[model samples]
Target: MAHGDITHIDIPVGDTQAARTFYSGLFGWDIAEVPGFEGYPMWRAPNQISGGGLAPRDASFTTPRSYVEVDSIDDTLAQVSSLGGKVLMGKSQISPTSWWAIFEDLDGNQLGLYEGVTSAE
Candidate 1:
């Protein structure tokens, strides 16, 4: 299960339009519905690059399991702290780039920033 990198992530919220508006207005992100995923908006990162998604908080909620792959979980955790975030879960191996953890930023926004790979990365 050595994930080369965190390919994508999904966040579940109760509202789509409000969620979209919040992200779009706050971060200037360009969000669009992923072609095949009905009601799921793929969130664009800064500079208009696709980063992840904002989806419905259904009973089958699954977006909480976001990921942040890293070369070294310890180092990444350190960086998270340096960047004003607190690790909620200590690093746990999911295999190489597949390891994971949770953290809260200074704003108390919970996010999982994984460092992994792409075919080209």
Candidate 2:
């Protein structure tokens, strides 16, 4: 809330290989899949992660969304409706301490939310 630091960006494309090639050839950056994370490949930028990724249309994922990291996703979601935004997907756990959710603003701008920790009840 005090400072805005963009951790990374995620771009959605139909084909990962083609997208990777296009970006690599154009920007001279290496976008490769990390050995362990087979499917996920982070955009390798000179300074910060620029953005890259293929849409997992056929997978358990829905339409691609861009995630924004926040201190607490619950508070953000709470302010959604008041700010004329609607939650497309409720808070869900991605990992032991990571949470994500999809939402739509009044202008219909789709956004993804990410919280650092997933509280255990």
Candidate 3:
């Protein structure tokens, strides 16, 4: 995906199994737990292109968070700070090739940023 495109979303749920069943039954999404990600079950929509994880709900993660694809998390976080936004989380690794971060906008809406390198590269 290109920069600024929404690549992933995280839905906070109290019950992973219930949420998986509800989403899969309601939207025909394929929800499953991938290896190495035991508690976090990922769900892929019928379209197959759109997918995200169902994270355990917490005080800090009470709502859905959409992750925007970015070229660089460092640069984007800098821009966000310059624009009066606050970085809630610093860049964290998902894998060797990917990283994610979270920031709160001026309006206090939290959003996530994703930076990944595809194997094709």
Using lDDT as the measure, which candidate wins? Answer: 3
> Which sections of candidate 1 miss by over 4 Å?
47-50, 60-63, 67-121
Instruction: Give the per-residue lDDT of model 2 (tens digit) for 8-71.
Output: 4566666778878888888877687755446766566765445544444455354556677787
Per-residue lDDT value at 55 in model 1 = 67
Candidate 1 residue-wise lDDT at 40? 79
Q: Backbone clashes in each candidate structure, one number apiece? A: 8, 0, 0
Ten residues in a row with the worst lDDT in model 2? 1-10
Model 2 CA lDDT for position 5: 43
| Candidate 3 wrong stretches, greater than 4 Å | 118-121
Tens digit of per-residue lDDT, candidate 3, span 7-103? 8899999999999889999999999888767899888888988989999999999999999999999999999999999999999998789899999
The candidates, ranked best first by TM-score, are 3, 2, 1
Q: Give a tens-digit lDDT track for model 1, residues 22-70.
A: 9889988888885445687777688544477786898746455455555
Top candidate (TM-score) = 3
Mind sharing the TM-score for model 2? Answer: 0.74
TM-score of each: 0.47, 0.74, 0.95
In terms of lDDT, model 1 sits at 0.69
Task: Work out candidate 3's RMSD over C-alphas.
Answer: 2.3
- Candidate 3 at residue 33, lDDT? 84
